[model samples]
Structures are given as structure tokens and as C-alpha cells.
Target: MTASSPTKQQDTNHFDPSAPPPFKVADIRAAIPDHCWIKNPYRSLSYVLRDILVILSLTFIAVVFKTSLWLWPVYWVAQGTMFWAVFVLGHDCGHGSFSDNPNLNSIMGHILHSSILVPFHGWRISHRTHHQNHGHVENDESWVPLSEKTYTALDAPTKLLRFKVPLPLFAYPLYLWKRSPGKSGSHFNPYSDMFAPNERRYIVTSTLCWTLMVANLIYLSTVIGPTLLFKLYIVPYLIFVMWLDFVTYLHHHGHEQKLPWYRGKEWSYLRGGLTTVDRDYGIFNNINHDIGTHVIHHLFPQIPHYRLVEATNAAKPVLGKYYREPKKSGPIPLHLIDNLVRSIKQDHYVSDAGDIVYYQTDYRMVGKKVE
Candidate 1:
């Protein structure tokens, strides 16, 4: 379809949250071939093994070349990207896309996610909230903007910290500790608002696993010098946080045009899901497990990551007006820095009253003179 075509334009250029979706969710699902939905346990396991082997090889190289702290920069980038891929696999497992067996899924999810310091069940439960309310302003789980009133209520230091570059990138660890403002929950705390009472045992188990991983890291730090441990573990872990923050924020926020956030009668599963943007990180696409193919994943989280690209391609015709083509990127996705900066500057808050809301810039908050 031409870029200007009405159907294509709706996907790329317009999202009217107050309006109902043009097509039924069933239509889009039907367009994706049945094979795209199949979960191949062996194939899923292969990806998990591949990422692990790559991580191990990178670690081995870093250790063998210990004297060359110069190589740490390269190690950080490679290992950090691989950690993101590991999280994606755990994410699939949480959705039961890794296999048919629930027990196996839970075991694999904990191993992959907790090893990276994420509480698996904790993240999974909250992420389930995100999936269920992808574009609802009041209820969306992550990266939803504050209302103007709330934005103004934040202290100057808090405002600066949130929009400042590099600072927001490090927010994942804190977010896992305490959720976004106006929400109260630690992914690590089962009693927090993110999870149900019945789910506390799973949350406790994942939190314990995360604690054990931290303890193991402390032991390794003592065995190896703290400096070396920081170089090996801490640096890569921070980079992983950057990847998580960058990817999650871009998926929901950095489009050239504002995506609508809905409320009340305006919201529906299909409508809310369409607000998610797909992104392209060029070569990192496969290494990151097709996570940038996000629109389809938001629509059908149970479809395995390996199959998202195929499913997205197959569903596009049916999703005609809902799928925005991702902005192209080079291997490093440096181009996204502009998108992020622009969004952070202009996309500050939405009006509390609108059923369909768009972000409004608060010039006073940013100390900018608006023309």
C-alpha cells in the first residue's frame, strides 16, 4: 500500500483513541498462518543455548585478556546486548511460549531472568499488566506519561532526573524496586500492588532466587577483586538496564506522531494494543530476539519471539491500519537518540479529562520558552 493510502495512513500516521478499531482482532489473528503460532520447545531451547554460549564466550575472552581493561568497553556492549536477548527468552517462557509444559516454562523463566537479577515471576506478573493495558493512560503498566498536574507536582530535582539522558536509562533497577510514580509496587515485593494475593508464593520464590544470585555475585566479588568484579558484572548489568529502558520506552513512546492513550468507553484490547510501536535495531534485531517486532507481540504475547517477525508480516494486511512501519536503524540504533530526546522534551503529560489523550509539553517544567 502507498504511504498515503487511507488504510496505511491509519497505521502509520493516525491513531484516534476515541474511535473503535476498524477491524476485529479475530481477523488479524486469522491472517497469521497457523504455523506461526506453533511453539517449538527445541527451537526455543536452541535460542536460550545460543545466547548462553555467546555470553560465556565473551566472558572467557574478557577473563583471558584480563590485563587489557581496554577491552572492557567492547565486552560491555556485546554482553549487555546478549543479556537483553536472555530476558526476551525468559519473557517468552513467562507467556508460556517456550513450551506446552507449565513447570518447564517456570523453571526456564526463573533461570534466565533471575540470572540477570530480574525477579522472574515478579516481572512476569507486572508485564502481564502491561500487556493487558498497553495504551490505557490510567492503567498502563509501564512508560505511560504523567498527567500535567502530576508532572507539575514533581519537585525540580525529580523532573530533571526523569528526563535527563543516561539517568532514565538506569531506571530499570529502581523500577524493579519501586514501580513508576502514582503506582506503588516493587517487583521484588509480592505484597506490592502489582500482584494478587494468590500469586505471592511465586513472587517469593523469584525474589529468593534473585537474592541468591546477588549473594553469589558477592562471593565472586570477594574471590576476585571488587574492581574486576565491577568490570565483569556491574558494567554489563548497567548496560542491560540501558537496553531494557531504551527498548521499553521506545516501544511505547518515541513515534514521530503521538500515539493515543485511551480511557473509559474508548478503550478495548485491540485499540490499546495498536498504540505500541514496532522498532528496528538493524543487526541487533536477531541478537535481541526480534523484540523490536513489538506490535505483534503486544497483540499476541503467547506467540514466541522467534516467530514475531513472521506473524507481523502475515498480519499486516489484516492489521492494515494498525501496524506502523518501524523506523530504520543502523546496527547500533544511534538514530533513536533523537527520538528519545524529542520525546523526553515534548511528551511530558496528558490531560486528565480526555478519553483520548496526547502528551503536552510543559515548557515551565523544562525551563524552555515556547514560541
Candidate 2:
């Protein structure tokens, strides 16, 4: 029952992730330097401006080389990564890490997210839910595993699409429209169960912003011709979705060691937050604004993205074995592709019974029989 006590089904390993951490959240907080917690508006704004300039530059280059087949694919990958970077900045705003000013956060969050066709407030609120309930089997929002019963109930086509590799990479758009399987509510719908009565107004505003962005895209597509628009915007947008899904999923799943999900008395904010894993994205460690430094961010989201590395390093001694050191990447993160594919094939669901559970492989999905 205590933080140091082992659970009923204890792993004989030296460290048990399911056991509550020996340190408290305050312990980690005290470890991080005070400056890491400070949010500077000017510095945050510079990132937004830089991302906007890069996006515009990419767009300009793509337009100039519109006729070149080779450049089109290159443009999609670069532009999409930039779009994901923009979303990370907006995500900081959602967590109040962008600055201390609410108005400034809202203004920037809307502009960045809307341009990428995301409902800013809707996603912010839902993401807040995800943070608050992370590692809770029933409550956590993004990439939470399905319960065994729920997984078995799913039809073959649904199972294949959900568990399949490339298909799952393209799931972000569908998730925005309808959240992960076994959950309901559109991120854009104010009346959906996801929001409270007072929160509906914010949802309505973001949904309208999202709609306006879509309308603007339609108008531009007509003006520039659909094919050109598809090459420039649509391809990049899809690629951005892939990056979003890929990064988000990897943060919670695909650890070499399995992570625990909690229910009932086993769940605590600190315990759930500890389940999050940091990643090394090699060159992208900076390009995507250090989102790969995620464990500390989940534990203390108010820490600016610029300072996550410092915060994590400071907290590491206290974190001890709980901190999973990320595998180093080469010039590119091609190594992560293996993690993604292996996790999809293996981490299909959790047991219905335990207060604490790890993902159970559905052997059938991987062409194996339960031994």
C-alpha cells in the first residue's frame, strides 16, 4: 500500500516500475533549477516566429520547384516535420509553458494549430485530460491500450487497421474526428462528452477556427488547382499526422521494458507520470524542440520545451532506475522504426482484472499461438 511496497504480482527484477516511486513529485520538482520553471514570452515568441518563417520558406521553395518530381517528396518530409514542430510550440502554449500570459498563449495556439487543421482548445483540453490521467487504464486519453475484452470484441478489419503498421501511422486525423477505439467524442464537437458545460464555449471557438482553416484551404486549392494543393498541402499534412502519431505512441509504448498501466488504488499522479519514457531523436532532439525529452515534461509540463533537457538532467539522480535512458540515434531516427513495428505487433491489449497491468500480446496478431 505504501510507495515502496511491491504489488501482488511483483517482478523479481531489481526495480519494479509498478511499485510506487521511492521519491515524491516534490522531490523531482526541487531537483530542477528554478530558472527551468520560468516561462519567457519573448523567447517563446521567437520560436513561433522562426517556425513560421521556415514554413513560409519551405512553401516558397516547393512552389518554385513545383514541376520537379524529386523535390516534391523532399518538400513533403521537410514541410511535415516543420508542421509537427509548429504543433509542439502550440502544445507548449496549451500547457502554459509558452509564456505566463494567457491571451498570448491562446492567440499563438489558435494560429499555429488552426493552420495545421487542429482544433486548438479542443485538443488542449483533451490533452490536459491525457496528462492528468496518464497510465490509468480506463481514463488516459492518447494511445492507451485496449482492454482484452474490448480488443477481442473488435472485428477483424478493425483489429488489422488498429494493429497494422502503416495504417496506425496515419491515425491522427481519424483520432481528431473520433478519439481512439473504445472512446467517443470528436475533438471539434462542443456538445461531445469530452467537455464540460463551461468548456463548451472554448470548444465552439476552436471548432470554428478549425472550420475556417478548412474553408481557406478549399479556396486556395481551387485557386491553385487541386493537384498542386495536394502536392503542397495535403501530402505535408498527412506526413505531419504520421509524425504526431509516431512520436506520441512511442512516448507511451515501445519501451524495451514493458510499462505498467494502473487502475483503482494503484494509480497515483507521480506513478502514472513515471510510466512515460524519454526518447533520443538524434538531430531531431532540437529540430522538434526536445519533445523527445518527455518524461520530465509529463511530470512538470509547465517547464518550457527549451529547458526540458536541463530539467531532466537535474531530476535524473532522483529518478534513478525509474528513468529509462533513451537509446541514442544516428544522424536520423531510423532505429525507432523497429520499436514502432514491434510494439504494434505485440502490445495489443491489457487484462481486465488487475489493478496494475502491462500490455498483453495478442499472439494471433503476430502469427503465434498462446503458449
Candidate 3:
């Protein structure tokens, strides 16, 4: 019933693919204390304000200390970390866990998400899709692996692109623009296949806000000069992309075992949600509002971020053998880099057709695809 350690052998791993988990969703939900479910608007907004204040403070210090080129590295890390925290708060809004009022969540979601160049409604809808289909092969949004047939069908360039590090790490912006492989439609486009007709207006509103943010940056560049703007925003924005890609990719992809992807009747909301692994960001557990408590967040997105840890502790007994213990981490999660590299090297694709499937590596395709 204990969580498995990182060093455990893959064959000895606890998850049994042949049978469905014994526990039911309601059982786990009932295990959590009632108080953990309450979402306090004031408490949520306090996090928003805290991240904004720190972000602005970092920017001000970097701008005034511009002559000290040496400090730019420190500024970039601090600012980028704060940017990720802001995104997490906005993420809470998208899930409707920030407050009881829909209007306030919308307004705050737009302000926080758009500032970071995310199209709020666009991302919200797709993210909701991700949550719904997390363990399904074809249906999962974001970081689902390719099937062997799909991988072989990809052009040489794309096959290569899929496994490379820095390139994949920077894929967030491109994903927002076009989405993942085998998926069509843009997060920026309301008419894209991912959205419904009624949802188009929300997508357009978010897109315009993103446009305005771009325009503001353009104007700022004209006044402050490109160098300062680059130092202040562009560099940090790329870092934010790295942070986003790093945290999310590991959540579902880099476990010791090749995590199963479900299909057809085998899939269920609780099963899909359990496929996600919790992570430890050490001190960053609070700085980013406990986002690394991902297993519980996936199980119950309605629980506010601040309450995820409490809910997670309460649910662990119920989760028992089902929970995948995260590898412990330092201030930064450097340990995961090994998991990431190993996955990229070996976990290339799953079988094309199966109710349950594990990743399959193409030995010939491995070295050839990473260049």
C-alpha cells in the first residue's frame, strides 16, 4: 500500500494493468474531509496579489539595476518562477476553484493568463479536455504519447523534433498556436475544432486580450528599447515556457513504469485522473501554490490549490496502492531530468490498437530521431 520508490524495478512496479483499480471514485471523495472542499475567494485573491507584487518587484529591481548585466541571470530565474506561480493561480480560476462567482473568475483569469500570453478560455477548454481524457490514447490533450503507427507515419523532421530537449521544452508557444501532433485546431482560433459554437465568443475575448498585451509590449519596446524589454520580459517568457513544459511533461510521462494509456470501455474519469503523478518542487510547493500535489488536483480540480496538500493527505489512505509516490526533490526538481531523458530515449510510442497499452521503443528510431 505504500508508494513506490524511484529506484524500484519496472517489472516489480505496483500498478497491475490487467485489472481495474479496486476502489471507486466516490470512496476516495468521501475520504477527503469536507472543509478541504471549500474555496475561499479572499484567500485565492491573496495568492494572486502576492504573485503580482513579487513579479512587479522583480521587474522594478531588474529595470533599475540594468547596468548590472551580471544580475540578469538571477532576475530571469526569479521573474520566471513568479510567472509560473501566476499561471498556477490563473489555472485555479480556469477550474472555477478560485471563487464562487463566475464573473470574478473570468475577469481574474483573463488578467493573469493573458498577461502571460495564454488565451484563457482557449486553454481552459483544451485543459478541460485534458482532464477528461487524461489516460486515453487518442483523446488526451497535451502530452499524450504517439502510437507506433503514428510515430512511423510522422515525417523524419517531426520524428526528430519530438524527442529533442531544448526544442521540446520551448514548444508551449507553438502548442498554443497549433496544438500537439495528431491534433488539429488552434488555441488562438475560436473556430478551431476544440471548441463549441457558443464558446467562440469567450475565445475571441481572450485572443483580443492577448493581442492587446502584445501591442503593449511593442509600445514598451519603443520607449524602453529592445534590450531592456528583452531583459525584462522576453527572456523570462521563454523561461516560463520551459517551466511549464518541464513541470507538465513530468506529471504524466516520466514515471518508472511506462504508464498505461486507456482506450474505449477501460477508461473512466477516476482512472484517467489517477494516471497523473504528484511531484515535489521542494520549497516551490508553496511558491507555486502546491501545483506539484498534482494527483489530488487531477482527482478533484474543484479543490483550491491551497487545499490540495490537505486533500492529498486525507485521500492517501484511500488511494493506497493506486498512488505513485513522487521522487523527492531539492529546491528545484533536478532529479526529474534523469526521468525525462530516459523516457525520451525509451518511451517513444504505444501500440496502435489496444484497450490498454504501454510504451514501445523503436531502437532504430531512437538515435536517429533525437537529432
Off by over 4 Å in 2: 1-13, 369-371
Residue range 214-271, candidate 3, lDDT tens digits = 9999999999999889999999998888889988988887465656777888888887
Top model number, lDDT: 2
TM-score of 2: 0.96
Residue-level lDDT of model 2, residues 30-141, one tens digit each, is 9999999999999999998898899899999999988888999899999999999999999998999999999999999999999999999999999999999998999999
* lDDT, each prediction: 0.85, 0.90, 0.85
Candidate 2 minimal-lDDT segment of 10 residues: 1-10
Model 3 residue runs over 4 Å out of place are: 1-10, 13-18, 368-371
| lDDT tens digits, residue span 1-371, model 1 | 01111223346645543356678889889999898888999999999999999999999999999888689899999888888889989999999989888998999999999999999999998899999998998899888778777887888777777888868888888889988876787998878878899999999999999999999999999898899889888889889989999999999984756677878777888989988999999888999899999998999998988889999999988876567788786677787888887787777778867777777778876688422
108 Cα displacement, candidate 3 (Å):
0.3
Error of 1 at 256 (Å): 2.0
Q: Output the better candidate (1/2) by lDDT.
A: 2
TM-score of each: 0.94, 0.96, 0.94
The C-alpha RMSD of each candidate to the native structure, in angstroms, is 3.9, 2.7, 3.6
* Pairs with backbone N, CA or C atoms under 3 Å apart (clashes), candidate 2: none
